[model samples]
Target: MASVSNPILVTGEPYTPGLTREAVCETYGVLVDEIAKLGSAENPLGPSPKALIAIAAAMGLTEQYPSWTAEPLRKAIAARYDVAPDEVVCGTGETEVISFIIRAYAGVGDKILMYRPCFPIYHLFAENEGRVPVYVDMGREMDFRVDAYVEALKSEPIRIAFLTNPHSPSGKLMAEADIRRICEAAGDALVVMDEAYIHFTETEGSLHLVKEFPNLIVLRTFSKAFGLAGLRAGFGIAAPEIIRPLWNIKPTWNMGHMQMAGAAAALTDHEHIRRTVDLIVEMRGYIAQRMSGLTAFRMVPGSRSNFFLIEVMDDRLDSTIVFEKLLERGVIIKDGSVSFRGLDKRFLRSDVGSKVNMDRLADALAAIEQSL
Candidate 1:
């Protein structure tokens, strides 16, 4: 038989998502209602009311194809960001947009630049496309080393560079000045700013940087703050010149009726967004305070996003031990050894959850520490 699969995909490191509530419940024999699902950086408040209404209204149209370009969503995003609609490209999720950019702008064996521990999709998508991913080590504690990225951008003939602000696992938000410095250094390379968690922070974000840099693309998603992770709605903003190719190459009717409807409606639901941000901020603080009293682990500082990391300081426990113990206690979180590259057995990642959920996690950790 002829080779059935592409070797790159057959051998590639597949993306591993956080465990779902059902899986945890099944494995741990815990009731669904008792599980504290802090593994995924999901909005604990749930979907926006306006978005729920819009999605319900659009459900009947599922039999028909959606707008060829998800026009309403594009328009909504454009209007909110003060950009031309033509400059926006919608996708199933920011992951799809990342894939599209790689397929459209990069070719086989081309170079892609990214930080050592980044949103895994950047490296995974590049590898799948047969592009070479060149990694720049982040500063200690996952800080964005702007000078290192600038040096890499100036030295390499890179086709694209991926930067995740309020970075995953660590949640450190990069300053605008550093971002501008990297953008300036990118000569012919397209710089993709993945701001999936931007809403959790107070910074205004780098959407305006797109207007200043022709090679810049700003990606945002409804998955995080808008509470539409299941809806899978995301879009990218760039100069029309850069967006034209992405739009041209994207799948026709990429977003379904409900996805587009929910996302567009969610964009205007400012109150829901505010509540989500506030909840994350408040719960994160609560969790931080709770973790501070524990001797088994310490919460990594500098997190401005919804999720933060916990580093195991006690010799008797590692991330794997804490992870399994938390699972036994019906608290699900991402074990850094499995979820992220460049991290080890000492770290685990948890997203902000409801007060009750945080209390469950805190109580579980306290129990574990007392046992130790």
Candidate 2:
């Protein structure tokens, strides 16, 4: 066979490293139907019952196109925060909105700023959109450091900045004051805050900040707390003029009718949000405490979110090995090297699942320790 490579293959084979169903179940020599199955690692609670009901009601509307403006959902979201509907726009997912924001504001040779160890989608969108992504280090000891970010902005010519409040992998929440400082430094640049994990944090408030900073755009998802990942619905909040440009670039009726209806229902179910957030908080404490006692790993301090990054001491074993080992035993985790630089082979990020699945993961990790 002839050897051929695509221009995008800067790194070998994109490296999915994910396990197949057969492989996942086979590793422990068990049937696919019976494996403990924590590797897929979505919300263990599944879709909200209210969302399901709404989706069911919208079934007949499948004959019709989704609402282009998503007017009803926008109004619902606005009412939740007492904002004007003009300030909101919905998308297929938060990732799609992020790409739209970057594309709408900047172009070839333009620059976008984001911190290191961020969601990989930001860099991917920037690179493909023919723009430069200027990355700032998130600081070694702390997940978010205002001084370093200010320094980066001081030196870089940034047209836009994407920040994840209650940042992923690290699962560290940023303070309101620090956010204001960042907004101040960006000068004329638009700040895109990815609050995908906002529901998981209690102390930080983002909706209030948008009213103060016209440059601020907040991206939120129903995928996490509302359990609507499968429906692919997320929305962005910004000044109407800022969001207006996006409609020109984005697909009209991109979100399905079912997803729009479901999202609106999810909003009305405030009790569900409260209960889900409370559960995550309790589980986070349990996991953090347990991980703290594990002498084999080092975790980031003061995590106030649903996921946490860990550094494994055994340098010989790569994150892939750790991930695959856990998968075999039915526990799945995110590998951090996808977004960050200088991550040792031992680094990995685990999401908080249901208590039952979490217990299985803990036992699996405990057993894997003996093998390692």
Pairs that collide in candidate 2 are 38-332, 39-332
TM-scores of the candidates in the order shown = 0.97, 0.91
> 235, model 1: CA deviation in Å?
0.4
lDDT of 2 by residue, 1-372 (tens): 654443333543232333445776656665675444433335556778899999999999888876688887888889887889999988987878997898899877798887887777787768766688887777675468678787877788888988898886677888888999999998889999899888888754587788889999989888888988879889999888888998878988787889888998998787787878888788777776676666666667766777777777665567777777777676666666643553556678777766775676667667767776
What's the CA error at residue 343 for candidate 1, in Å? 0.6
Residue 279 lDDT in candidate 2: 80
Task: Give me the runs in candidate 1 sitting further than 4 Å from their true place.
Answer: 2-5
Q: Per-residue lDDT of 1-372 in model 1, one digit per residue for the tens?
A: 576345888888999998888998899999989999998888899999999999999999978988888888889998998999999999999989999999998899999999977778898889887899999987767788888889888888999999999888799999888998888898789999999999888888999989899999999999999999988989999998998888889887788999988999999999999998988898889999999999888899989999998999999999999999999999999999988888889989988889999999889989999998
Q: Report the Cα lDDT for candidate 1.
A: 0.90
TM-score of 2: 0.91
- Which of the numbered candidates is closest to the native, going by highest lDDT? 1
